[model samples]
Target: MKTPTSPIVAPVALLTSAVLLTSAALLTACSSMGGTSQKFDQASVPESVRVPAGHKVAWETTGRGLITYECRDKANAPGMVEWVFVGPQADLWDRAGRKVGTYYGPPATWEAMDGSKVTATQLAVAPAGEGNLPYQLVKANPAMGSGAMQGVTYIQRVALKGGVAPAMACTMAGKGQRQTVGYQADYIFWKS
Candidate 1:
């Protein structure tokens, strides 16, 4: 024999479940909206990726990284990056979220973790985000690492966000101390 309350219990349980599901969805949506990826604009992709009249894009790498600076004071020069250490080191990840290589430079270089590296020279520059370095067009030297970067003709660093020179002026007193700042940018690789 069915209890008088069984039918009522079923309906109430269904309604409660519906309410909980709706609330969970709303929270998920809100959390996604707060992410940094929301601020990224594809249209703002740096022109450093563009090649000469006939060339095309060989490959492109997009990733976030730290703009590392070590405390440095060279001869107490006028207004140099006194807190400069090795060029920044940024881990470059592929679309699959796998770390395939690293972009580290001041001399501006890229190294594939698998075993290849290339150095690039800045050819042109334009400003990017508030605290970031300038968007730069560069030309890469031959690849030394024997990996993916071989035969890379041109390289560009652009859409940078946060790789600024150190805030405090580096002095002889502060020499040898290291500092790392957070930064993100797009690295474009072009071949001849």
Candidate 2:
């Protein structure tokens, strides 16, 4: 014995299944493209610079910019000259190649396109290599204005490339001279 099926019921069921399948496919694609479920590996990172447990990555961006250094007298060492870090000026971009924000300051601030911003204190650092800046972990202060930076607890700077101070002599004659060097790094934001 066969029960007759309603024409409307059959089409509705098929449409619902198709929508579900499309959603699932989209989710899978997002994850593969560095979505929320993407895991950040820290196995090769020094223990000192690794993010603490109980936190997960909330955002990730590639920062490409210039780091300025100034030739000045060495602190506490009169007559000795050295390059001192001035600050950084950089643009942040997401994995999708969209420009999202800026990072600049003597206070190390990260600002989002939505006007949300955060300043951080360095927690630890580990050497990356010669001629490269060290990998770093920073503790973020409470975000101001509440957007992308809200609830961010930590920030890790990794995959460093070329931010070291200029190698030219910081002699007395070169005092106060400023040099800007190019750099690129991945900044991973974490939340508890």
Candidate 3:
């Protein structure tokens, strides 16, 4: 026969167990939201990854990954936006086996070394009735029958194992025409 206090102890134990289980569940949910596999945020991005002018990027992943990015502005021009991959330059050797000229390497493969990845693409936009601007500038010589050129569009994609929050910007390329814009995106991934 158990004492009255024994019954009380059993109930207290059951309640404690329930609370611990609930706390564990909550922690798991929060971790999923804050993992590295999630999208990127301006506050979270490193200054080194920002897009530079006249550079095209391509991001890829072998197993799984996620990336978040933003651009100031993107407008279309006359020519198609040319995304390119280049190789390194060869160095000329002097008679003394000295190095000369620049030794450039092939275009870098935008791959994540840590089994993760992210990428962005820019597009073009025109004014009221100007129409869709070309993604690339065909010819920029007024003497050659060209008026003005525009910029390309902006695109960014983030892939992660859990969650992500990414942002990007867009703008027009012209005197007093460029305007900065902001963007946001979310993505998720799961394994079998």
Candidate 4:
């Protein structure tokens, strides 16, 4: 009593499915490693990192660093509650490969070799990807340190590579376990 399906309909459906899949694959490829690299766009920066009416990018540096994750509960007890991102401790370098500064986060700071440092608190966040670390937008201000970071207005973390916490399970008994993953990013400093 059921009508037979049309042979032409099946082929059209298959072709449509293939095209959709192909489009998805292309999008994923654009965001994947060895596919595309990240670049800074001033207009698109997070609100916290966006410069005020007149200020411009005063300085920028590229850094090679590691993001540290601690497996601790809410009360600082040494068991796996969640993979809390402690922050990054990285060595900053210039375009010519010269060591320029260092970045430390969670109490986010950028310190230059001459002892100038700026610290900021995150105001916004963006996920770089599921497997990669999240990018942050911070409001930076002068801290104890001197030179490069003294008068900074903001700091933006972008172009994240690696740094996600491991999938390893942490039990309640495994309280003090700490994991550090390698990552690299570019930090842009805005100043008037």
Q: Clashing residue pairs, candidate 1?
A: 70-85, 72-82, 72-83, 116-145, 117-145, 132-162
Give lDDT tens digits, candidate 4, residues 72-118: 78565543377677888999976546798888876777888999887
All models: lDDT? 0.71, 0.92, 0.28, 0.75
Tell me how candidate 3 scores on lDDT.
0.28
lDDT of candidate 1 at residue 86, scale 0 to 100: 67
TM-score preference between candidates 1 and 2, better one: 2
**How many residue pairs clash in each candidate at the backbone level?**
6, 0, 34, 7
Q: For model 4, what is the error of residue 49's alpha carbon versus the real structure, in angstroms, after optimal superposition?
A: 5.2
Ten contiguous residues with the weakest lDDT in model 4: 31-40
Q: What residue pairs are clashing in model 4?
A: 78-175, 79-175, 115-146, 116-145, 116-146, 116-147, 117-145
Which residue window of length 10 is worst by lDDT in model 1? Answer: 34-43
TM for every model, in the order presented, reads 0.64, 0.81, 0.23, 0.69
lDDT (Cα, tens digit) per residue for candidate 2, span 1-192: 999999899999999999999999999987766566345687768899999899998888999999999999999999999999999999999876779999999899999999999999998999999999999999999999979999999999998999999888789999999999999998999999
Candidate maximizing lDDT: 2
| CA-RMSD of model 4 | 16.1
Mark the regions of model 3 whose C-alpha exceeds 4 Å error after superposition: 1-5, 36-192
Ranking by lDDT: 2, 4, 1, 3
**For model 1, how does the per-residue alpha-carbon lDDT over 1-192 read when each residue is reduced to its tens digit?**
965777688899999999999999988876664432433233465555444555455556665777777775555665554655567778886544567788776777788877888987767777776677887777888899666888888876765777887787676677777777778877777777
Off by over 4 Å in 2: 1-38
After TM-score superposition, what is the CA distance of residue 87 in candidate 4 from its true location, in Å?
3.1
Model 3 per-residue lDDT tens digits across residues 1-192:
964676689899999999999999988876664333433342332333233354332211122222222222223654322222222122222222333212123221121123222222222221211221111111111111111111211222222122122222222332222222222121111111
